[model samples]
Target: MAGKKEDEQQKQLEFEQDEVLTVLARSGDASAFNELVRRHRLKAFTWASRISKDPHLSEDIVQEALIRAFLNLNSLAHNHRFLGWFKSIVRNQALMKMRRGGLYRRELPATALQTASMHQASVQVDDINSIMDYLIARSSQAENDGTSKDPQVLLERREWYGIIRAFLRVLTPREKSIFESFFFQECSPQEIAQLFQISVGNVYKIISRSRQKVQEERLSFLIRAQIRQRREDGLLKQNVLDPVSLKESGGSLLTGTEQLYRFVKARHPQLSLSYVDGMLLGAFLLNIEKSSVDMSSTNMIDRNYLITNGMLNLGMRVRYVEAFDFEPPDPNLTTEGIALAQGSVDLGMPAMVWELIHSEFGLIYGYDDMKQQFYGLDTQSDEMVPYEQLGRLQTRSLFVLGFVGDHPISPSDSLWRWCQMISRHARGQDQTFSGFVNGLAAYDTWMDVIRQRAIEPLGHAYTINVLRQSRKHAMICLAELVSEWGEVKSESEINQTIFNLLNKAEEQYAIVHDRYVELALLFPVPSGGEPNEPANAARAIELIKHIKYAEQLGIEWIEQIAERLEEHASRAHVPAIVENPPRAYIM
Candidate 1:
């Protein structure tokens, strides 16, 4: 009687303390709020358990409810009503959790708490109904006919037993023993709990967790078995890539090329996306054709040649296949190209595809031979293309590129090749499209189009966005070079000079990056802002001009770095050998 009286006194003190704490918590006292949680967390869990009836689910509900309450404390009407408001939140959370599980359609009955205690027992009782019915029917038939049991019937029984064994194998040894004793041997949970020397709740939890684990594994095992049987019967030929996600780009052919490059780069730890972009000249490329800023100008160069050259520079042996290259599609070429694409996907390498969906490059990462379909993703989204219509989707052209192997190349050789490519691309020395003005000339054309208000708003905006992102990467690449050079223990004065040049180059690109960013704001994508307006167009022109001058300065410093690399090569004079030379198949 005294203990009960002491409990009442303690409860009175707690309620008074909570009233003061709630007022402090409302005023943004974090420690006061923490004290309130400490006092009420156990009571919250109990309330949630009463409402949810599942202890595991109740735990989650309590946690989420507390977070919601904390986030919404300011909405409480009265400080002294904190407990009531928190209880309401906990109840709402429990209901939401039940609704998501599809278990709360109507109001729960008053006897739900009593019935929930028997739920585990009911499930265990239902497990034997199917097995017992099957056995009883088979025994009755055998006795009445006095004939040998059907072979198929025995096989079915064996299959059921095999499944049981498989499920047991998925459990730990202790779990297997406990589960067998409780379910197969018909031992009560209390007896098992005592035998295992564990609490009754622990026994229930272990059984629940083990059952869920077995059920999940059983489904996966059955699925794989079904697939295997279908394959053996020649009913299916399907291959789906797992755990693959495309590294999206700003909608350029380099998007597809970079995806392919990433797969090949997995074999070389020395390569990174920034490094690849630097080597591919993707970050530095600017091509404006016919004094117009159009869509095609972003990728007007020889795509196949550039991709092949870039991969080779990285020492990756590339396999290139195409059915149409500025020519009519041939059936023979399509067949060869499709076969190679499927083979590359089968080898777990994403194949770069041209016109896979729209009139642009994409990737074919998976296929289904029986369904005659290929799974790919493009700028639009993931798509399933019919196998026979591989090259006839849009442009009636097929182009695919993948890496077969790699050769050895020193970092110095790779850097030198990259610098040479950068210089060539910046100088427009390797421009394949005639009307297109590349490099510094391209920037002038961009400004001319803006000044005349002849810019294609969408294309201009896209160019601004892509180049802005690319130049940001260019800045990162230059900074990476500075760090790499700083790490070299060379005493050569040329090394320090080159490092200084790289820093200067990085600074120029940083300015160029900022200019592009300013332009992007003036002509935000899809909407293109108000670039068609004279004021915005004039501002865009000025930004482009600034970008051009800074880019030119960056290129000058890059050329100086290349000169220093040449000097270093001369000093070594080791007769730099190129073995196998990064082979490519252009067919």
Candidate 2:
């Protein structure tokens, strides 16, 4: 008895599974086929109803589609694919029915505008006839103007018809009938009065009131559609920032800085890439997470604030909008961040954002609202990120920066601001997060890890590669500064002294760059180049020490340059730095 009960239970479970039913049906099991029909009948009907826009016609279509699906069931090889295959048959039958009836138009029935009015019980039979007459007249006009072929014009016409139909529902039945005759049936005022046993004056008055009511609803519909189209247009326009390569860049933040620099130069054509990098001190910024067991330490820092500060030094008005939470990011903040990012893109600036394509800094260059995706550039590739997934990626944080406009500063003043930023970073002032070491202290932390032979080889190699790229950029920046100020053609001793200091700084950065390049080669990225092996580790340590010494000397030279600029400002009775420099707006 127990064995019989188990068999019955097993049979019941198989009956409940679609794959099982599909396989049995394919094998000519009549009862199994009937069960499949019973389960999917209502869904098939609903799909057909939406397509055919007539319940009676949809019922016939679904019935025919089901018969065809059953006859062709044996041709379906995969049981799991049965549902999708069955639905396609239903869709095909619906479309074939529409085409046979001369009602097909761009995936919807051509008679869609009249379907609601004709089928709804609230609309009288005579009202349906009047609506048909009205539709005929409008269809003739649409064809004459070539609007019948335009989907947008057809869509708008359908919306207007729907608005008119809904307005009629709000009126008394008698009033609805009279209005339909006058407006849709094209009855004269005298004829309408005679047919309704009312005075011609009353008929005209009724027509006026009904027209006013429908007009209000029509206006509202038009306003709503206009706003929707504008928003969709804003999103769909492909506003990709000219692509920047991510080949050798290590840190996502520096990659973002590179893209933002392009945006800045677009507005101020006189600014060079190296100059902008120097102003941001992109090469000098560093943060090391001592407790982090992997390569994330290379990018670990107070990223958003540091970017804001860098842009401020360049005399650019900027805003930093960020939302951060633990795993399962807050939906409300995600929504707010997306809006702000879209707003920035709409303003003709590529938004510098975080974790767009991955858990890394990147740029949101374009968007597609219809597809609900954002076009972004990152280390992986140019990718389309679904809008809903922006803040829900690995980092569970949203950070966006919009560069508004330039504030215009003299070259000397900009250079001075750069010095102050470099000084702060070198002193580890920007290290805000706990368990992290930044600026000059980051070097010591990194060296200590190497000494202990506790290096995550790949991460260590990646860090070395990133630092290498940064110092190379630093060398170029220093050279640009010296060349820029050397062209000043000034006899002032202070001007000459600043130029000399910058030249010395450029040499020191060059040495730092060379040392880093050697280290990068000694510990290649991805494979990590055997950094843990004793001899290699010793060589890497020596290179790192030389890199630190050269960078320190470079920082000292910048300090002297800043001092000389201050002295010159004092002698010229000009302020060395703007006291109330523009503040970065955080949203």
Candidate 3:
């Protein structure tokens, strides 16, 4: 009893402190506002960092947000709600930075906060206050009525487990499995899709239907309880009880922002084309097609590396940011993700998100702060994910865009770098996997795996798909290079020889690509089926051997081309190598 009394006193003291700070800050006490900033700086920085993925920029955004909060302090109706209001400001600032391509005036007049009026800030504050009031009232009513038991909370209490078990009975077996996997086990839709041999779209549909069923039953129970209460109270007239709308109970807070990409383009004149074209251009500059596979995982490769390489290859700077090195139990992770995505959208650049619901690369293009929803496209589908939903994923990776400085390597120098990379790949140098070989040698290792049936059928199929896609892109790159360099009249002989070798290599890769496509169809990744009979498996092995032969031939041709280019470099007027080449952060 004594300890409980002490706890209450402590809480009261903290409340008083908060009230005092709030009042002082609102009355233009600069020191009080600075104190508030000091208290919330780390959290605000964390939120901004998650969104912008750039610590330097995140710091700028947080400072701007605090200044804005100070200027608009009068707009806040309640001092207790200061943190939430300030968080919203930080989110908005991050979004604005993203839309402006990270361009913001760092210096503000010292008196700017004091001089600014609260008129502009009142509108947003009023909106936030209204929503908060409604939610608070609803929560209070639920507590008073003894109907505040959340489904998850009930499940946690072993005595109340029966309640959840009974509610789950409404779902069919398949629906139950999907619901459990999605909500309980926390498996991503893509992982579930792979396990069940279904599409990601179907996974979502199933989860939705199950949730709707549960909600309908819940509504039915509530209606029956209300009717019984009215009957017991001797209220004969039906009008005595207000009608309840079923739609209200099942409605979601998730919503999408309108015209975000359009707004981005309008604001930034340099981005004349669609994001798709920009992504492709980045890919080409980085030579991503050449480094899309890891010999060990087969289907898995380091996407962060690819993005970084692409940006660097284009002479553009980049910053890699992550929410955490390892997963944390903090609830604020989702808020951070939403803010980060919103910031990227505001910048007019897409946030390249990793470990999405589909276990694939997702581009977050828009966000609705009011509804707390992020709109993005994955390899499987375009969808709107709730802000809270982002926290459930395993990994949260972000790629923050930076401006392109002067060309790090000239066109000719870039070509030379490409030659070196290709040679390294051909020789299987700098392999990421220790046990498994890489590049040309990876073909032999893969062939061995196929012959032994060591890899799963679905895994093999996915690998083949990656190979086919990468090879097709490689062919495009080769063709583009040939066309680009072919016009140079000075290096005609050498260029023709290089072009001929490239064409041959393209043909070789094309054949291998077509074979992989055929093999992938036989395995059928979406089916999640077992490999074919022994004869068919043997046939695949033979095809792998053929692929190996073709790849070896391509390697020989590349080596010869490298030799020819070197010889030409000796005779031709090659530009002297710069002593200090431009440097940019790679990852």
Candidate 4:
């Protein structure tokens, strides 16, 4: 009974004290405002740090959040809810940073809060220190075995700090503050309690939560690194590279920014962005992120390093980027993301890519060096499983229905309409053609790759998968024609065949679409759940919904086309044709 009474008294005193601070701060008292900032800045810093990941950037975010809060003091509804309001400011700042930077393109979405919260939990539960340790260990093991050269090993080792810094940025402001203080500030439970005028035990809880962010950062680093390394080492068995690289620099190993730039340009002619541009953007991202450290780079040498490697230009487009550029998170900032966003809104630059990443990942605002996790990397080079070939059995099935029509030879115009109309639409029913956008981004590469494909024929790529995928759709459409109107031997026949298929496919698609309107159901997810619930499972998740639809339609088309393929198959130089095929597809 005595302890309960004491608890009530303590709460009452804290409440009164909060009321005092609110009144003083609101009354235009600079001293009071400064005092408030002094008391909460660390927590704010931590929150900013978790969201932005870069200490210097996180610090800026903290300052900006405070400034905004102070300027908007008149809008405060309840004095006691000051903490919540402050948190709101930090959250907004972080989200803005992400939306502005293009770091968080988006991922498969579940319902709103549920999906967001789950993503946050994944970022928080992992340990930053442990993840860093694991990454370093991975480097050490690889070094010991001579699997990779010492420089490559060391690069990954050095990047561990970057990973930590990036991960810290992903944390929610509250979580970030807790983790920052626990790890960086070393504020004991007793000291924190006296400072907050709260129970020492509550402080401990906050500290524990902070520690968890560290763990998460570390784990994320290892996981991502492993995925990348596997692809590099040929474990993934895909394309060797995007053809954008320095010819294995023999002795010194391509360190010059100009040399690297030229090499990438030669391989991918239409692609352009310089290293300095990347740094400039990175600095902007970091400064606004401001979770903890000072944002000044006055002490660093090699100013040219940033300038020389910062930008790139391919043809008419100018691209600003960093070597390993990291994009900001989505409009919804994750725990370790950007802290603020300031940019032109016209390009819809802040639009979300709600179908890209796995559900477990959170969006971010800035950078966190110590945490070594980032909101997103600039270039993720991969030979994307061709758009036409990416879906599961069901996704392919839906696509088949979408393209096939009542008249067997008719090709689906719905597919053409989707591709043509969606590239420009913004919202509502206009977004129904979202599948094309998904397909475009799904090409498993950066903008640079697109340029490469544009300048050099797709035939230039070395991957057989690329070859097969590029023509699969054309073949499928051709097959649909044969199924409806029998075999054709001449060019005129083929042209007429294509025409008939296109005209009839629209009708067939509409008929089937009405019958199986449930296809769209595959895309919807339960709210508050990670959108890729199945992807996170031990086994492969279901395919992207539309991809499944395509496969269903394509399979039937392939069966029809395969008969004609036999005649050509008997031709003598299959290998020669594969190596130096005529420009048959494009023409």
**RMSD of candidates 1 onward, in order:** 25.0, 21.9, 22.8, 25.5
Clashing pairs in 3: 51-340, 98-346, 98-347, 99-346, 99-347
For residues 1-587, could you state the per-residue lDDT of candidate 3 as single tens digits? 99657545443433456567889878877656766775667668766664565667888898899889988999998998888798889987876676466632432211112212321221122122212222333344446867557653233333222344455678999888887676545488999999889999999999888865664444334434444554577643211111111011111110110122222232333432223122222111111112122222532233344344434333444343344323321233333344445544544455555554465445565565434456655545667765555534664332223222323545454455455445555575532422345566666666555554555656556656555555555555666666666676346787788778777866776676677677767766665345546776777778777876876776677677767777767524433322222111111
Each model's total of backbone clashes:
0, 0, 5, 126
Which scores better on TM-score, 1 or 4? 1
Model 4 segments more than 4 A misplaced: 1-67, 72-88, 92-213, 216-587
Q: Flag regions of model 3 displaced more than 4 Å.
A: 1-296, 323-326, 329-347, 355-358, 366-375, 379-409, 489-492, 521-532, 560-587
The superposed Cα distance between candidate 4 and the true structure at residue 57, in angstroms, equals: 18
Off by over 4 Å in 1: 1-242, 245-254, 264-272, 325-328, 342-348, 357-360, 366-387, 489-495, 570-587
lDDT of 2 by residue, 1-587 (tens): 99657545544744578898888888888767777776777567755654665656777888899899989998887898887799889987986687577333323333334443433432222233223434554566577878777776466446545645765765677888898787655588899999999999999889777765554443334333433665767543335545553233433335666666655664555776666666777778777765333577655555555556667666677676555543333333355556666666776666777788777677777776556577777666788887666666785666677666666667777777778778878987654455568887788877776766768888877887777777777888888878877887286787788889999999999999899888888888789888778899788778878878888998999999888888677425223433222211111
Q: Candidates' lDDT values, in order? A: 0.66, 0.67, 0.51, 0.34
Model 2 earns a TM-score of: 0.53
Q: How well does each candidate superpose onto the true structure, as a TM-score? A: 0.52, 0.53, 0.43, 0.22
Better of 1 and 4 by lDDT: 1
* Model 1 per-residue lDDT tens digits across residues 1-587: 99657545444444557778888777887767777886777567756654455556777898899889888999999888898899899977886676466243223322122233332232221223223323343444556776436675455445444546656677899888877676555477899999999988888888877775665454444334444555687652767664244544433335654565455554454655666676666778888855457577665655665666677666776676654433223333355566666666666666777777777677777777656577887766788876555566555566777656665666566666667677777887764555467878778777766765667778878877878877887898888888888876276776788788889999999999999999888888888787768888778778888998999999988888778788777525322322222211111
Best-matching candidate per TM-score: 2
Worst 10 residues of 3 by lDDT: 249-258
Worst 10 residues of 1 by lDDT: 578-587
The lDDT-based order of candidates, best leading, equals: 2, 1, 3, 4
> lDDT tens string, model 4, 330-383?
112221111110010111111111111221111111222233222221122212
